[model samples]
Target: MAMTLSTPPVPADWTRHTPFSDPGRHAELLEDVAPSPEAIGPVVRNLLAHYRAEGVNMPVSSRDDINLRWVEEMLSVDQERHPGRSLQDPRATEARLQGCCRDHTLLSVSILRGQGIPARSRVGFADYFVPGWHSDHVVAELHDGERWRRFDPEVAPESGLLPDPWDLEVGPGAPFTTAAEAYRALRAGELDAASYGVAPDHELSGDAFVLTEVFWELAHRYGDELLLWDGWGAIPAPEEEMSEDLLALLDEVAEQLIAADAGDKDAEQALHALYVRDDRLHPGERVLRFSPLGDGPVAVDLRRGEDAVTRPGIP
Candidate 1:
């Protein structure tokens, strides 16, 4: 029962809607990539089965806590097997049932659909820290009478509203280009609470998204050449080590933020805290150090400002 409808794509309108503003609207302006209704269904059933096998129950209502518990458990299971690939995209699907954030969303959508409820996938920058250089999030929308309901599989109702994906409170505002840009701005103090907006009761694990990004950078840059172990190879580091990179990236981003203001003193000072003095601003756990160019006993701290921190292997 999937039909392509023509409508202006408005992804960030956080308020839920039913039957869509336009019944024929299919291509959401916010959706860079969309899944076929058919594609979405199987993904959901697979997730349900996967979790059900592990003894998880579906949410009876829009209980954030229950949903979040499911999300955490799902991620934990996936992390145990595929630690490096935990995102909210279907592209990261490893098995019929297992997937990243996107996959989870798709699964949620399917569950809603199975109940004869029309649901759609919403993709956007989520401020909550998971693991990566950027924030990407997925959630399901259900049309319940007049207004649609916003449901987050990743957010636990009990945990409350996770941090706004960009720390911007939930409301209508000018849309930003990418989540990374939004995050960089927030980090640099460019976007104030008033500008970016906010979300209610949102929670995040800073290490998850930050570390994922760092590990990805390392893998791309040094893994193939095996520079870390004298050509031995680059194995994906742990979560804490990966988050350490967030500090490094944040430092650079902070400088960029200052530069955006034409060398504003405040921005420059902020950058100084991160770049100069090599203070371990956010020192991550110290892991077995390895040289990027060659074999050497170098301490690697994924945390920002750690002297051991080096440039990421990839952009």
Candidate 2:
């Protein structure tokens, strides 16, 4: 007999706040700017007109360009004003007008959660823009009572940036691959790891990037919001060095991520517990900031509370 599976219940506050998704940090950064996740995209669309994306249109003049870890860091202007500001709230980020895809995604997650919506960030590869390649990317997802809906705040129609804005009304036809899907594809050999990251010239590919994202996505669902480079398990190792055992582990990790993406509370708890003891993976009340710049990514530090460690005394 075919049995029916039930979806578990997730708390409304599960995705609410971490130092990573603190919307109050937005208002704390700019009193005039309401830290509304709903309003963040419009603000980003407007802000990008002036603030160039670091490493893309703009050059990394200082670590500030790369070190802006949290969503709020995008708000501050100039290195002299806020150097090494680890996390920038939306208001502050808007003020500065600089950020990468991760910053845009974090801001959206923060704003949405502050509005009392269950939202979280997803790390994966996007195939929507450059047909042949899956670019390393991040996006936001919210539970609309019945099912989880994906939202690419960076590609919102208001920005007119992405060639194809994912239509929430129509459901998930977007260009990005969730960490779970990437893991599955790689494991099945349906997709090669070399084609996984940005362009062929980019460094990532093989199992390392896809598996790292799966691990990252698992942590994000359980509210850890780990930094991009907080490697454990198989993260820092080269793909050629990965073993069969590691591949099997990645398969399990992918399952958990897929479950979390589908809003499985049981899987969420399982992943949380799995990473609970890994000091590097489980920041608990702390957040590790990852800055993807230069040949190797930089690690900021572990921070506690919602306040930006990089910019204290602002509030």
lDDT of each: 0.34, 0.56
Where is the poorest 10-residue window by lDDT in model 1?
219-228
Per-residue lDDT of model 2, residues 233-271, tens digit only:
345444456567656766776787677666587886676
Q: Which regions of candidate 1 are displaced past 4 Å?
A: 1-97, 130-134, 160-169, 172-315
Each prediction's TM-score versus the true structure = 0.27, 0.72
lDDT of 2 at 92: 42
Residue 141 lDDT, candidate 2, scale 0-100: 72
- Per lDDT, the best of the predicted structures is 2
Q: Write the per-residue lDDT of candidate 1 for residues 145-239, one digit (tens) a residue.
A: 43334445544334444533212233334221233344455556665432222222222224233322322222211111111121112223333
What's the C-alpha lDDT at position 272 in model 2?
A: 56
Task: Output the TM-score of candidate 2.
Answer: 0.72
Report the C-alpha displacement of residue 135, candidate 1, in angstroms.
1.4
